[model samples]
Target: LTFDDCNKSDRAFVAGVLRKHGFGATFYVTEGLGFLRNKENYVTWEEIVELDRMGFEIGNHTRTHPHMPGLSPGEMRKELLHIEKRCKEHGIQKPTTFCYPGFGHSLSCVRELQRLNYLFARRGVGPEFKDGGRGGRGPAYDPGVDHPLLVPTTGYAGPDWKMKDLMWAVDQAREGRIAVLCYHGVPAREHPWVNCNPEDFRKHMDYLGEKNCTVISMSDLSLFVDPRKGPEDPYAPIRARMKREK
Candidate 1:
């Protein structure tokens, strides 16, 4: 999945490309940075509605995209809950997944998200969440990490970057491990650090398709290990069967 800042033009362009390829993604909305909400540098509410109508999941990023680790617990609550309320007002129900601003969060942030009943609370895919090592410094590719919650994503920085590291992720997906590729832009024209052009994205998507894998929302991934199940699953048989089918 990817997020475009207050770039309405970028939103439409990227969404169009994903739809063209029959792939869906999530756009984590930052309320305060919205186009109509913030006329300076972000996408408009109408653009968000347009993408929502197109079957892309609209998730909560935050009100201002502040670093959660920097906020007090109450402030973090406001950032998480207020944006959630705003999403519902815009007709987005159960906005359960959140992308931490700059991958910043504290345990208090986790409590706040859980209090709000978020199902998928995650940072980027990386070693910190994976093997308990820290994630990437910038958007550099670091293969094979462990944590699902702090899912370390190999930023496909356009087509060239796609050629370099997108395969590592696709390989994991084929092995039944969830591969979450996070990106900053569809065309890495502005932010080369975590940007990727559409052609590269298409090639990457094509690779996933070739693996006979399904592209799913974070919600689908959450169902894999429902906290309520508490490790020893009462539903393991059913899930295992489904996995085998896949």
Candidate 2:
């Protein structure tokens, strides 16, 4: 399971819940807002450091959480670099995984992320790069079959998500496939679009425990992913085809 946005209150809340069950999650931090405390009840740099010490994986969610598709290559690079720098300054380990801000990404940014040595990047459920835009939910992730940069999530856990939806996604995880679940906040109203009620959140965690699901951090999943595989650019072949016609 993965939590995004790095909410301050959720930090302790989530950690307590997971620790009780002996599970851990990857908290995707946006250091720009975190350092500035721009979001109400957002985690501070010190708290982020504490999260790491508590045995949770702190993954990068960019510096400012910009709409990735709209960022120029330079801006995108800065987003990752700045967060990496901030995390390092606070003695946090350099994050090897990234979660797309607002579930948004540009195909161009994929190569840049690879250049930066990010082990993997997560996107919401969808056929990756569909119609040249990003979006997709998954049945389960087979690392050998999925692109490293465009890893598919099972789905987002928000007001619209029912327990059945989560159970279905978890059921998809058997046979060496991974179910990557995304959540924003617990009792999350700060960002209504991605909020999950605390009670509902517990139920999901309890379910995982009851079923004996192997909850893992993104970096844990990275061990099985082959970075050298997949299209360097999904469009590369298309671009080559165009060149031939030209």
Candidate 3:
């Protein structure tokens, strides 16, 4: 799920790539940015509506894209709920997923999201397993979190750097783990904060296809894991058998 700070010009570009491969993406929109203001750095609200019409889920990322974890309770509430409202205002009702800006979340962020009835939130960390691999890298992961509201993501940014991240995710999924990729803009524009080239994006998608991993959004993953157990279930047996102190 991607297209952070997207613009109208690249909407079709990103959409075409994914559609060609029989996959779709969910775009989390930042309020009042980009095409909404008709600015030089974003896609239009019309374009977002079009994407929504094209089987893509439009989620919220707060208006003005602030870090809620740092804000006061009142400010955090204002930051997230207001955006959630705007998403509804634009016909994206019942938006269930949210991504904190810069992966920033706090007790306040979680509370506010819960208040707004968000079912899942995406974080930026994964479990640490010493799976056999090259030069000290570890094993992949499976989803189903202790906190269903907080999910993890594997982001792919540069074509070169992305291949490694993709391989890691594929490895984990092959071992029956879940890999949710957190990514940003497409078509390679300014702002390193929101820049990913088209070709680079394709590499990650191609990897998913080749690896045969079911590409899905955060909510889809929740349904994959057994709620009775949690994210820690997969590693439970291993943890007990390995009694040697680290």
Candidate 4:
């Protein structure tokens, strides 16, 4: 499980629930999206440190959340490095995982993450499934076939996502495939589009627990797949999957 955008509810609500069930998740942090100015909706650096202390993986979501495809390599580097610098100052270990801001990524972004030595990165399901806006379905991560930098999200929680969708996503975690899930605030106030209702979030977590799913952080993937290895043609698996679906 992965939570994005440094939502304050992560500290207030999400952490307690995860702790209660002994589940592991990654909380991707960033200073953008009025995070510094809007404490009501976002988490503070101190709270971010507390999250790291809680043993949840803290991954980089860039300094300012921007569409990565729109930025030059230098700009992207700067954005990522700024977060790394902050993590250092706060005594949080350098993040080995990254999430593309707004799910906007490109080969340039992929190369930049590789240069930074990120072990894994997550992107929205696309080029196979049409962009689902905020929450939608996509292929599970097949490490043997997909690029580590282009790991696809099996599901993202939003207004459109439901319990059935969550079940379908988790079901894909078999035969060496991983179902990577993305979520925002349990009750994301500022970003209503990606908001997951608190009740629904609890139900989802409960379901995972009941089913005995081995929920893991993004960094945990390294234990199963070598980060340095990637398919010869990154998009080939996606194309083949699309053809099979058709």
Q: Which candidate's TM-score is highest?
A: 4
Query: Model 4: runs farther than 4 Å from truth?
Result: none
* TM-score of each model, paired residue for residue: 0.74, 0.86, 0.77, 0.97
TM-score of 4: 0.97
Candidate number achieving the greatest lDDT relative to the actual structure: 4
Our model 1 lands, by Cα RMSD against the true structure, at 7.6
Better of 1 and 4 by lDDT: 4
Question: What C-alpha lDDT values do all the predictions have?
Answer: 0.58, 0.76, 0.59, 0.92
In candidate 3, stretches whose alpha carbon ends up further than 4 angstroms from where it belongs are 7-10, 32-38, 125-141, 158-160, 225-246
lDDT of 3 by residue, 1-246 (tens): 545545543476777777777775667777644435655567766777777787777777777777666788788777777767766767766567777765566666766776777767665443333322111223333443335445545443433344676677566555455556656656445455445667777887887777665666555555666433444333343243344324
- CA displacement after TM-score superposition, residue 131 of candidate 1 (Å): 15
lDDT of 2: 0.76
- Cα lDDT tens digits, model 2, 1-246, are 788887865566888998899886899988554447555668777788888998989898998888899999899999999889988899989999999987776687787888898888887664432321221245366665566777778867766677887888888887777888888778665667567778888898999999998788888875666666776564443344346656
Candidate 2: C-alpha RMSD to true structure equals 5.0
Could you give candidate 1's per-residue lDDT for residues 27-126 as a string of tens digits? 7777653434544445667777777788887778888878788899888888777767877777876577778876665567766776777766556533
Q: On residues 24-56, what C-alpha lDDT tens digit does candidate 4 reach at each position?
A: 999999999979899999999999999899999
Q: List the residue pairs that clash in candidate 2.
A: 125-136, 125-137, 126-135, 126-136, 126-137
How big is the positional error of residue 61 in model 1, measured in Å on the Cα after superposition?
A: 0.6
Measured with C-alpha atoms, the lDDT of residue 173 in candidate 2 is 84
The candidate 3 region of ten consecutive residues with least summed lDDT is 131-140
Alpha-carbon shift of residue 6 in model 1 (angstroms)? 5.4
